[model samples]
Target: MFCRDSESFALFLFSTDPRLIQTATQSGVGGVVVDWESIGKAERQVGFDTQINHDTVEDLARVRAATRARVLCRLNAFGPTTQAEIEAAIDNGADELLLPMVRSANEVETVLAWVNGRCDLGILIETEAAVERSGELARLPISRVYVGLHDLAIERKTANPFQAIADGTVERLRAAFEVPFGFAGLTLPDRGFPIPCRLLMAEMARLRCDFTFLRRSFHRDTFNLDLRYAIARIRRAMREAFARSTAELEVEHRRLLEAIATADGYFRARCEMNRTDAVQAASQ
Candidate 1:
C-alpha cells in the first residue's frame, strides 16, 4: 500500500457508505486512506478558517468492522483544528496519517512531534520548497511522499495546469523513478488522457511504489467498470514489467545451475582423497 509497506490493494475511501469497505474487502483491496474532511461537514465560515463537523467516530467504527485492511488518515492541511483532527484519527486506530500541503522539512518535523509516535507519516509535497527537499522527506519517518500534482503545477510555472503536469519535475522523477511512491494528483476524468496517467503509473511500479490514489473524475464516480478499466491498464503495465524481471531472474538461475555442476567434479575428487585418508587411518 502507499502509506503501508505490506502487500495488498490500496483503496482510498471518501464515501460514507459502510458497505464500501465491505465491497473493497470482497474485491481483495488491502488498505484505505480516508480523507477526514470528506466525512466531515463544511465550516460555517467562507474563508480558510473552516470547521468540519461530522460523525467521524461512527464512520470509523463501521470502517473498522468491515476489514483488516491497513487504515490511514488524510487530515485537514491547515487551521486551528488540524492537530485535533489528526489526534482524533490516531485515536481511531489509523495506522498512518498524511499531512497535506507541507512546504518545509521543519513543518514535517513539527507534525512528527505532534504525532508523537502515534502513527506513521506521509507528506504531500506541494510547494517549490517541498519539491526541493523531497529527498530529505523520503529519509524521514514518512512512509510515502505524495506529490500533489495540482498544487505543484500551479505553484510552479507552466503554460497550463495540465501542461505543468506534463512538463514538470514530477514527470522527470517518473521517468527515472525510485522507491517511495508519488500520487497522480487531481487528474479528473474530464481532463482526458494524453496527460500521462499511464506513464505516471508505469514510473510508480518501476520505482517500486506500492500504490497511488485515484481521485474521482466525476461525482458519483464509484469504482465501477470505467475505474476498473483504468486500473487494468496500469496493472497490465506492471505485470509486463514483472515478467521482464522474472525472465532476467531465470537467466541468472541457469548460470548458477551451470556453475554448481562445474563445481561438483572438484567436490567429488576432494571426497575421494578424504576417503583414502580414512582408509589409511583404519589400517594404522
Candidate 2:
C-alpha cells in the first residue's frame, strides 16, 4: 500500500459492512471511511438530494478489525462533543481523522492540538469561509484534503453542486496545498450523471488529484461486476488524462464546465417552476 501522500490514485470506499470492506481492501482500495460527520447536516441540506450517515465509534472498531487497510474517520465540525469524538475515534483505531465543515484556522488547529500526532489528520473544505482560510490549514501537517462538493454547493446555494470544479475553486485550493488533493468521486469510467466519470477523470488528471472516494453510484454500478476491473478502468482513465495535450485538456475541461452549467440552468428553472406552483396553490 502506498503512503497517504504518495502520487498514486487512492480510492476510498465508504462502508461499515465488513464483507464490503474486505472485498474493497482485497481489490486495492486505499482506505475504508467510517463516517461519523452528521451533525446538523439534515437541516442544512434540507430539500437537497443528500443523505446523512449516523455511523458510530463502534463501527470504526468493527471496520478496524475487519481489514488491514487504512480506516479514515470523518468527525463532525467543532462542537461540545468534538474532543470526545476525537478521543473515541483514536481509541477505536482510526488511522486518520478527517474533520469536516470546519469554519476557521482555529478549528483545524484545535483538532491538531487534540490529536497531538496520535494519528494522521485531514480536513474537508465545505464552506466559503473554510476555502478562504484553507491556505493556512494546508501549511500545517495535515495528511490530505478532499473538497466536499455536496456541502459546499449547499453552503453557497448554487444550483449545481459541481460549480466549484467548473469555477476553479477546487483548483485554487489544490494549488495552495503541497499535500495530496482530491474532490468529487469516481464510479465506472463509462458512467456518471450530468458530468460523465470520464470527463471528471480528465479534470482530476488536469488537477493531478491524488485520491477520491468511490461514490454510491459506483457501488450500484459495480455490484454484480468485478470490482477489480472497475477500479482498473478508473485508474487507466486517470493515466490516459496525462496523455492529452494542454489544448486537449482545456477542451475537455470546457466541455465539462459547459455540461455543469447546462445542468445548473435546468435546476434553476425547475426551482422557479416549483415556486410558481407553490404561489398558485397558496392563492387558490
Candidate 3:
C-alpha cells in the first residue's frame, strides 16, 4: 500500500486515540501509515532514550487498541533506521510495514531478512530501475506494490499525468505483477489533486488495483478524512483523471502519427528530387 510521510500518520494517531474511538470509528480511514524510522530518535546507541518523555509508542499502541483501523509502518530503506523502525513497528503491532525505495531483488531480500519472517510487507517502486526490476519485486513476499507515480513520472520524463499513465508504466506494472497493487495518483505534481475519492475507487476497480493512498491534500474536519468522503473523492478523481488521460493520449498519439507521416512525405519528396536529377544527367 502507498504510505506517505510518517509524521502525519503519527499526528493522526496521537490526536484520535483513547477518548476519540467513536469519532475515529466514524472517520472511515483504513488506518494511519507511520514511518517508524522517523517517529522518534534513539537517544542511546542500542535503543530509544527513556529520559525524554514522549508516549509515542504507548500512544500508538493505544490507538491500535482503540481503533479498528490498521497501523502500517513505512521504514527507511536499508538505512540505519530500518532496524529500529522494524522493531518499533513490531512492538506497536503495526499491521503492515511499507518498505520504501527498494531498488533490487537483493534489497527486497534484505528487508525480508530483517523482518525475520514476521509482519506484513509492502513496497514502493519509485525509480526507473525499480520498474525495470518490478517482476522480481512482485515475486517477493510483499503484500502490495504501490505505484509511486510522481517519481516514476519524473524518471520517465512524462510530466503530464495523462501521459504518465499512458506511458505504459502503470499498464506494464499491472500486466507484469498481475496482482492488485496500490497507486499514488492523488499527490502533488500529479493531476489527481484533492483526490476525488469516487474516481480513485473507480480507477482502482478498473485497474483492479487493491488500494490507492489517499491524497494528503483532501482536507478533513478532524485530523483525517472521513472514510466515505475519502473513498468517494479518490474514486471520482480517478475517473475524471482517466478520461482526461485518455483524451491527452489520443492527442499525443495523433501528433506523433502526424509527425511520422510528415517525415515520410519529406523523405519521398527528396527521393523524387534525386530521381529527377538522375534523369537530367542521363539526358545530358
Candidate 4:
C-alpha cells in the first residue's frame, strides 16, 4: 500500500483543496501525505511555520473518492491528545499514520497500541536521538522509515542535510531495517539544490529508496507543465539511473559522494561567512 516495491512515489499537499488532490492523484503519484501535524498550537509556539488545515477528514475522503492514491495522515507529536488524533485519522479514511520527531521505540509501541494494525505506521527520522536509536526503532512494526532532511538539518545544525546520506546515516538505517527506507526530498526534475537532480536520483536508486515526497518545488516548477508529464519525467530518469550496469552505478555513486562533500564544504563556508558578516554589522 505504501509502495514498498522498487518504484517510489508520493506528493505532499498541505491544503485540503480538492482540485490539488485530484491533480496529484491523477498525475501518477502513488500516494498523498495529508499534513495535520503542523496545525497544533503547541507546534506553532515552537516557531514552526506550519499551515493549519481544518478539513483533514473532508480532504482525505475527497481524495479517496477521487483517486486510488493512498492517503497518509501525519499526526502531531505523540502526547495526551495523540489518541484522539489517531482515531480521527483512522476513521477519516487514512491508509497510514506517520509520526514525526520520534525519539524512541517506546513511543512507537505506544502508538501501535492505538493502531493495532488498522493502518500502516511510519516515522520521520529527523532528530539525532532518532538516528542514534534507529536500530532499536527498526525492530518495531513500521511500514517504512523516511529521513526528514529539512528538520534533521535544523536539529543537527548541519550546513548540508544531504551530508547525512553521504556520511553513512542512511546506510546504517537501511541495514537496520528490512522495511522500505527513504531519504531526501524531491522537487521538479530540473530544480535540485545543493546537488544536481540526476545525481540525487542516482543515489536514491542505488540506495533502493522506496519513496519520496514531491514538495514545494514540484508545485512551483510544474506550473506550466502537465502534472502527469512531470511525474513521468522523474520516474523515467530514475529508471534510467537504475538501468546502468553495477560497475557504472558504482562509479557514479562515488562521483555523487564527492559532489556531496564539496556541497557540504560550500554550505559550511557560506554559513561561517554570514555569521562573520553579521557580527561585523552588529559591532559597527
Candidate 5:
C-alpha cells in the first residue's frame, strides 16, 4: 500500500505528536509511521545506537485524525499478541500495519490470514534468517517491505550496518521483492555525519528505491528552515540523481563504500578503546 509510486519516492515520518505529524504531512511528508515495535529491542540493543519509541494505539488514532495522508503502525514482531495488535491498529485507523523482525514466511502468512485484507500488510527484513528466507517471504502477497538497518546491524553483528548497502546485502534484499520497497533513512541531502545524505540518495536512486524513512535528524539538521523548501530540495536532487549515467552511479557507489569503511573503522576503533578503558578501570 505504501511506496507504490515508481516515478518518485515517498518519505515516511516516525513520530507520535499529532501536531508535529500534521505539520510534516502538510509540508510534503508522504506518510505518518507510529512505531510500537519495542518488544525486546532494549534487550537486543543494550549498548548500541537504538531508538525504542513508545507510541500507542491511541496515539495512532490521534495521528490518524490529524492527517489525510497514509498512517502506518509498526507492530511488535509477529507473536502471540499480533492479532490483537493488528485488530487494534485497524480499528484505530491504521491504513497499514508494518511487521518487524520477521524470520519466516509462516509468520507473515499467519498475519495475512488474520488481517483478512482488512488493511495492507508490510514487513521488515532486519534479521539474518529473514535475509536467507527473503525469496520465500517476497513471494507472499505482502503489501510492501522495508529493509531495516538497525535490527539488521545487531543481527549481523557488524559495527556499521550501512556496510550492508556497500557489500550487496541491501541489493540482495532489494532484488527479492517486486512490491513497493525501501530501506535506510534520510535527513537533509547536504547533511549526515560520516556518510553524507547526498551519497545515500544517489544509492537509492541507483537502486530505484520506492521510498525511505525521514530520519529524526532531518528536522534537527535542517530545523528553522522552511519544510516545503527542504523537501523540494531533496526531491530535486533525487530527480537529478535518477538521470545519472552508469559511470556516475558507479563513482557514487565507490564514494559510499569509502564512507562506510571509514565510519566502520572508526567505530571499531572506538569500541576497542572503550573495552580497554573498561579493563583498565576494573584493574584499578
Candidate 6:
C-alpha cells in the first residue's frame, strides 16, 4: 500500500512495449501508471494524445509477470462504462485503481461501492468543484489523491498549471487528508520546466509528498542516462532537499512562492489582453 512518509516514490507511465515496463521496473520506480483514462475517446477528443494511446491489458499482464514494481491502473472518470473498465483493469492485474476528474464525494462513494476493497483506490483532483469540495472528498476512504495539473489549470484558466503548488491549494488538501497526496508531475534534472525539476522535487519533499508521476519529460531528458541511475539521482536529491535546515528550506520556499506569483501575473495579463482584443474585434 502507498503510504505518506518522508521517503518519496516515483511512478512512471506504463507503455504497451514490454521493454518499457521492464526498464521502468529495473529503473527503481515505485510503480507504473497504466493510463486507460487518457486513451479514452473523451480524453482524446480533448486533445490528450501521446505516443502510446491504446489499452494495455495484455501489456499490463506482462508487466506484472516481468516486474516486482506495483501496477496502478488509471480508469476513466465515472461514466457509462466505468464499471466495465474497472472490472477489466482488475482482471488484468491492477494493484490499484486511479479514477480521474472526480467531482464529488458521491462519486467517490459510488466508486468505493464498486471497488469494495478489491484494490487500493486513488482519485485525481482536477476541477474547481473538486477543490472546493476537497474537504468532503478527503473524508472518503481512499488511498491517495493526486492533483492533476493539466486539467486543473485548464479548469481554472490559470497561466501556470503548477500555481496550485505555490498558491497553498495543495497545502489545504494536505491538512484535510490523512492519506498520501501529491501534486505536479516530475521530469529529469536537465529538463528546465516552468518550475525547475530540482526545485519541484525539493518542494515536494518539503511538503512530504509520498509520490509523483514521472512524465514524458523524464524519458526525453534521461535518454542517455541509465534509467535506474536517473531515478536514484532524483530520489537522492529529494532526500537531501528534505534534510536541509529549516532556514534554508524557508528561503527556497519564499523564492518558489515569488516565482509562482510572477507566472500567475503573466498569465492574468495575457488573458486580459486576449479579452480586450476580442472586445475590439466585436465592436469593429
Best by TM-score: 5
Query: What TM-score goes with each of the models?
Result: 0.63, 0.90, 0.60, 0.83, 0.91, 0.84
What lDDT is reached at residue 190 by model 5? 86
- List CA RMSD, all candidates: 24.0, 3.8, 16.6, 4.5, 3.2, 4.9
Residue 86 lDDT, candidate 5, scale 0-100: 93
Please identify model 6 stretches exceeding 4 Å from their true place: 1-12, 39-52, 264-284
CA lDDT of each candidate?
A: 0.54, 0.84, 0.54, 0.74, 0.84, 0.74
Which parts of model 3 are misplaced by more than 4 Å? Answer: 1-28, 36-59, 156-163, 185-201, 220-284
Q: Give the clashing residue pairs of candidate 1, or none.
A: 189-217
Q: Clashes in model 5: which pairs?
A: none
Q: Could you give candidate 3's per-residue lDDT for residues 8-40 as a string of tens digits?
A: 221122133455444533544446554443333
TM-score of the candidate numbered 5? 0.91
Number of clashing residue pairs, candidate 4:
0
Q: Give per-residue lDDT, candidate 2, residue 21.
A: 84
For candidate 2, the C-alpha RMSD (Å) to the true structure equals: 3.8
Q: lDDT tens digits, residues 16-72, model 4?
A: 556767776676666777777754434322222223445466666776666566888
